[model samples]
Target: MTVSRFYSPQSIAEATAILRQQSGCQVLAGGTDLLVQMRNGVKQPEYIVDIKEIPGIRDVTLTNQGLTLGAAAPAQSVTERPDIAAAYPGLVEAIDMIGSTQIQGRCSVGGNLCNASPAADTVPALIAVGAVCHVVGGEGVRQVRVEDFNTGPGENCLKRDELLISLFIPRPGVGSADAYLRFTPRTEMDIAVVGAGVSLSLDPMGTVSAARVAIGAAAPTALLVEEAAAAIIGTTLEESALAALAAAAGAAASPISDKRGSAGYRTKVVGVMARRAAQIACDRAQQRQRRAH
Candidate 1:
């Protein structure tokens, strides 16, 4: 590890100013990922800008419009909120898989995202739910779709001087629900071999209305598959529609062969995962719809 200067920025302005003025500086959130990288010598920064001290950066606010999750909010804190879980169950499911109970106290949803791992559990869920990254820098603030935030493995679109402030997720409508599923070697605390997230709504007539499907661990980044969603958007989620959804999801995968699974195996598995996740989402949406009526 390299010797580094640490700055606890008390505000967003101070954080951004440090980022703009300092070279080779890295933002420290929950540090579940960054600290490990530093210890392993994968990352050696000259300065560490700890944003935990920033006001409102660790808060979780949900309004009539949507959810605003602070960049440094602990995973446990967010997941423990009944309102958050009720509104976004798929997202809660993903965050719940981040690590053991001890790690969850220190890990964060935003940090998991900024790590930019292809297999990060939360990315696909966030993308499926239409989550947007709120970025701030000397250039000012901008909103980026979560799907577009990551460019590749361990890489994101944020400039060196930019900081991810928070995440904004749109409110799910009536008769809508979501689900996430991942195939891991173990039942717990293992990386995903292939992950799928589905968010969908059922019209009053029980036909599919709006839907989004996203796949992770089978691509350079989590991908939003329009074709997979389109496969079931108009019809009721019948057997044929699910088969098409699986096929489209399989066709979208571009994975590298690894010890856990082969490229071909992952491609096929992601499709299956997507199909299953979609079914789960559909079932949840139906249940919600029944209650709404």
Candidate 2:
């Protein structure tokens, strides 16, 4: 197998035009996943349109709505953003845990989501933060919630010629914090057996105002447990509430037995991770609230 044709586009318009004109053309961002798949003969694209050279695709900006992370922005870039780390620690933590420093240098969040791996670390964090994906195609642009982005394992709603433009993460309020946690056989360089991220917001009276909990690796795509979140809203987190949320989180998982972990273990760990992450996020949220006062 050989990559015979490579097209490097200088602009998004050129990339979109190339994609529309070429058949079997795979859009290449960082090539961290695509190159490996191609080399392993898992995928063989007739044309590779390299989008890394396109300008303005790597910007990370803080906006009134929240944060807009460009599709081509490297993982290292996302992990190092002080604003992102301070505002959305779960996302930063997840980004830090992805691959190694070298791999992070070459991996883009868009590429990670577009790859649509069941265990992708960033998905859970994104889902917890209520992130939306901006996609562009010949039909123009549209936004899809991160929760709805992945259709299933290794599959997403993106069309053949559509490209992910950026990710939009809503800003957490002043009294909010987020945490991401994952369990694996070894630390670093290993895919998660089960991963969870939680974002919690406290009201002025020290009660829970809003919450979002998302789990990964325990489901075909990132799973949002709304019922678990509802269990904690409108009150300070209690042990019993946390337990209920954990159980709900575990019950929502639909995992399969695989070499990395069993479905039972995945379910149990998803609960543990979700509970601990929620507690951690609550503590952090309290600290942020105190600091703001």
Candidate 3:
């Protein structure tokens, strides 16, 4: 297996052009996954377009609506952003668990999504937060919800000529907090056997207003457990309600038996993770309200 050609484009437009002109061209961001895949003969692209040099793709800034993160932004950048940590703590936790410090320095969120691994840590958290991906191609630009971005394991909805531009993550409301939790055999540097992210907003009266729960490594793509989330709406956090939500989340999961874990084990952990994540998120939301006061 040999990488025959390499192209480093300075601009998004140039990158898109090269993608349109060449066949079997794979876009390279941090090369954390692509390089290893190529080395393992899992991927052997004729043209490797290095997009790291492209400008305007690494900016991470706060916007009025929320945070606009450049696709090329490193995972460490997101994990370290005060605003991201304050608004979406789950996202911070997910990114922080992606890999070691060295891996975080070179891995980008865009790359994580593009790699389209079912065990990708950031996907579940981003999906739970209602994050949207901005994609640009020869045709134009469009936005896709993170939940719909990945089609299956190691597959995404990106067109052959499309380039992921950025991610638009809306800031949580005044009384909102999000948390991500995962279960793995090891504490770190291990893929999640089961993962869950919960984002919830509480009303002034302490009732649940909005809720989103997403689970990963339990299905082809990270799935939003709407029924599970709905179980908590219009109610205060209670053990019974949390248990019901957890049951729903477990039912919603479509895990398969694999080397990492068994389907039964994954399903059980999905429930446990869902309940724990919801409780953690609610606690964080309450804390945020207290801080604001």
Global lDDT for candidate 2? Answer: 0.90
Q: Model 3, 1-293: lDDT tens per residue?
A: 67689999999899999999999999988888999998999998999998888887888888668988788888888888887788888988998987889999989999998999998889999998999999999999999999999999999999999999899989788799999999999998999999999999999888999999999999999999999999999889787899899999999999999888999999999999989999999999999888888
Would you list the clashing residue pairs of candidate 1? none
Q: Write the per-residue lDDT of candidate 1 for residues 41-81, one digit (tens) a residue.
A: 99998999999999988999999899999999999998899
Query: For residues 52-82, what per-residue lDDT tens digits would candidate 2 score against the true structure?
Result: 8887678889876799888988999888888
Better of 1 and 2 by TM-score: 1
How much lDDT does candidate 3 score?
Answer: 0.91
**How far in Å is the alpha carbon of 169 misplaced in model 1?**
0.7
CA shift of 279, model 2, Å? 0.7
Which stretches in model 2 have alpha-carbon errors above 4 Å? none
TM-score of 2: 0.97
lDDT: which is higher, 1 or 2? 1
Ranking by TM-score: 1, 3, 2
Highest lDDT scorer = 1
